[model samples]
Target: MKRILVPTDFSAHAENALKVAAQVAKKNNSEIILLHMLELPHQMNDAITSGASIPETMLFMKKANETLDEISNRNYLDGIEITEIVKMDKPIHGITQVSKEYEIDLIVMGSHGASGIEELLIGSNTEKVVRNSEIPVLVIKKENPDFSASEIVFASDLSEEAYLPFEKLLKFAKLFDSKLHLVTICTPNSFKPTHEIEKITKSFISKFDFSNLETHIYNDTNIENGIINFSNSINADVISMCTHGRTGFAHFFNGSISEGLVNHAIKPVLTFKV
Candidate 1:
């Protein structure tokens, strides 16, 4: 049976992710694992000792349990087993640890599109989990629930790591009966039509029996703009890419393509660790 791991923070976005995971599990006949990682601030314990009355931690756990109970009682997941895991640690660390321990096949989480100071300081937990975990991470943009992913757009540089997640992506495409669109952007300076690219694309497609697979190559100056524009042109339901989680000087000026796509894309952006 397929095991789906969903990490929740009890936010509306996380709850939406849980709902999506349930739909996916019901469709695939898989079990759902509802995980919540509680990373209490450093002052949490101190506040308690200082009589600040920080019961919010307990409240979070209680709400998580209640939500899990609600999901379990749903008629859609009648036979599918539902498990709840509550951990006190950083969200990304907890997610990665649970994914390894449980051998999770897929991870579903929500992204709030963090930006500016918040993003610069802590970075994105979703991005961190995507970079650290070996499993497939599906990030749902909370604004676009009505958008069912009928077409999946994959942005790749044709790197070795890019191909590693194809197995999982193909499985997901088959499960959803969605069309797969593989795209690679070539800049003016990087413009070179090589046989290797063709071979790689063909070999990848040959492995899948999908009837609705399309490959495209775009010549553009900005990679991010190319991806976003192509996705918009095709009206893709979802976009998938591999993130390296680069930071510091390299990241400050160049910025992260995956984070930029997630922040700008109107559709769901599913990221897999390379």
Candidate 2:
């Protein structure tokens, strides 16, 4: 966790994310890279790519840099090394490209918590970044979030494929020095007897030999609701889950339940691809 990448549209939500990034950076002695993507007009997109010296591009870059400078100067940002990045690309593409190019350890981003059809339009950028990013992504949905997560609820299916993400989750939990509450959401669509669920949960726990952890099987109408309810019941500070990184028609048809939680969960969500 040497570096954190934070993409901003300068909205209240993005400011919340930057605040969270600052907290994490201070704790880890990390650098915060604030990125602003300049989504050029359709006609200027291709033309400006070839050193066209377009005034619009120049103006956009100048304004973005100025905004970043202003944000970096905030009193809250003191003591942390904040770098501003302005790129000419789509938000998702720019974020992914910069994350890889800079070798960022974690990507902290904010979503407006859009849902239903609105989410498909507005919230898709953050969701797309989550699906595409190989590194772990932490999503903040509120305007002012508690960056320090003392209690983290990690919800998983406990499958063999889940171990990798769970490993990543452990590293994250260590960062916060938080107790982990491992849980499985038993929904109506995939109901399981309590004895059977416990057997499987115990088997998975044995593989990791994880100590100072508690496990539970939560029942509800669906995975999203179950995770939310369980997390709230325990007064969790962070909600974590694994995503399969499904894309194309598979993602379209099945839709990602983890993503659904991302859209609605008020607590910070830590997600990684399985």
**Alpha-carbon TM-score of each model against the true structure:** 0.78, 0.90
lDDT of 1 by residue, 86-203 (tens): 7877877888888888889888877665442123212467656766667877777664435465799987765555565666677778878899899877676556585667777777
TM-score of predicted structure 2: 0.90
Candidate 2 C-alpha error for residue 178, in Å: 1.0
Predictions: Cα RMSD each: 4.6, 2.9
Error of 1 at 58 (Å): 5.7
lDDT string, candidate 2, 1-274, tens digits = 8999998888877888889988899889999999988787776877777767588788888989999999999987899998899987778888889998989999988766644313421256777777767888888777653577789888876878778888888887788788899888787687879898799889888888458689988998888789899999999988877766665111211455645565577787887876
Flag clash pairs in model 1: none
**Model 1, clash count?**
0
